[model samples]
Target: MKNIKSLLLLLIITSFGFSSCQKDIVFVEGSGPGGTKPTTYTTKMSAKVDGVLVECEFAYAQQYTNPDGTKDIQIYGIKSAQSFILDFQNFKGVGTYNAADLISSGTYVSGVNDPFNNGHYAESGTIKVTTYNSKVIIGTFEFKAVNTIGEIKTITEGQFVISLEPIPGPTPGNTTTNITAKVDGVATDFTGQAAYVKSTLIGNVMTIVGTNGVKAITIAIYNYKGSGTYEIDIDAQGSYNEDQSQTGSYATENGVKTGKLIITSATSNTIKGTFEFTAPNMVSSLSTKKTITEGKFDMSYTTTTM
Candidate 1:
């Protein structure tokens, strides 16, 4: 009887221990019975906005190489009506970056109406990059941002795991292709896929287009010459389209010769230039214009005989 009781007690203890171990075992996202680990992970960003946790449904990172070989990195995430953005100038790999340094900054956008113009800019913050490489970027950030109207937000506990991919451009062996300008005093970065350069086989004509996914700026030069200033007149033209449908379009008046394009360097495969133009609204009968200034582009081109 004593041996039987001892064996039963041992079995109960072993059973309890096995149950506890099973409970403690945690499985990964796809490590269940019929699932396998995903080869690629999705980009993720999450943060607490004034104590409320929010996760971004879409997130992306873009790196732009400047003419001086410095790198500018922009990380963006969007969740519902809110958006978050971080800009790092002269990025030098894994390290802690502060917004007070004036080279790096953060932005928070709320509401869907006029998000671009109504967003808040970071007044103070710190971002610690734990891992940064060609494949991925992992970081934690927090900021105190203020809007134009002085509305403030405290964003905290921010974390991101962003996947990086090469940006395709016309340039061979070049991964960075972007155009930046100031439109009516507002800074704009044209880094979308639509930004490109196309030239004729004879190399007499060229058209360059850049967009920020919302607005597009186009420059067409006729009788193209190397390293020279071109007038925005009959020989060269400029246009600004506000939307994809191009319902609201603006163009420089022909023969008016209001703006100029200065080609600093024009090579067989690449072109570096600066341009500025005043384009009047073509869609509206009323007289309105957009001033594009400090425009710069360093891009490769694809030549066609047709």
Candidate 2:
């Protein structure tokens, strides 16, 4: 999840523009589940383009708390650069809203394609709020949107379950001063005697990078901020900063040496984790695979927002 925070920020601006809006809208419901209620927040959207059925999966969820005591639910579905955004203002009970009703409220903005100046508008559609609580929101939506060039796209089967509660922070734990591991059966250590270990946690992802002289290793865990084992995301996991891009550098590979990130503990200001990976030389001609094992880290971090 590289630059995910940036991506979400852009999405907030292009999708809803919460800050520039008018009076707030609030959605609230009592606790406990009713009969036949869903247990999760899930969403999907699809349509037919050029006689081919194209489905866009729900990609992200964001909730904006307004100063006027109102809230906005922002859901995004993406199929390539083309996308759709559904904004539910003051999302309350199980109610149906048509295009006119939603537009009149000025809290609704449903559209397709790029959401910038060149975006499209939904000519007609309905948004339904099935159920909601402080923890989750469940809803369904459909729209017939057209672009400025007079291109029409029908979006259907749109639904989502967005979690609204805050994520739990890590517990209290001791901090270690060094990171120890082995590279291809050779002992490797980063005692923090020369350089400090740097760590950053944003959303559910945590990234850590350490160095010793010219050798550096980076480890990242996605969809994770708690104690658990996670398989590396091959495309955006970690890298070995050696080789100086000569013959290319090395990356964590799935097979051959298989990579793993194990987070033992976490807190708002501290994190502890272990990792291992079979770093493959990006340049295929370089046959050496750096095996990093028994890797460990315990570091403190600070939070920053943009």
lDDT of each: 0.67, 0.52
Clashes by residue pair, model 1: none
Candidate 2 C-alpha lDDT tens digits along 1-306: 111233433333333222221112233334666545333333344444434555553345455444466655556555543455566566554677663245312112233223333355567878777866655556776667666677666656666555454322122223433566777777665532111112232234345655554466666554444677877644226566552333335776543337777778877667787887777776455587677888888776543232
TM-score of predicted structure 2: 0.38
- Alpha-carbon shift of residue 199 in model 1 (angstroms): 36
Locate the minimum summed-lDDT window of 10 residues in model 1: 16-25
Angstrom error at residue 72, model 2: 2.0
| Stretches of candidate 2 exceeding 4 Å from the true structure | 1-58, 100-118, 166-306
Worst 10 residues of 2 by lDDT: 193-202
lDDT of 2 at 63: 58
Off by over 4 Å in 1: 1-40, 115-117, 166-306
TM per prediction: 0.44, 0.38
State each candidate's clash count: 0, 7
In the range 1-306, model 1's lDDT, one tens digit per residue, is 001122112222222221211111122344668777644545688899899998876666766555577888888776655767788889988999995466888888774344334478888989989977766788999999888778888989999878675322222223443677898899877742211222232225566766554477778776676689999966788887665332356788779987999989978868888989999876444477889899998877654322
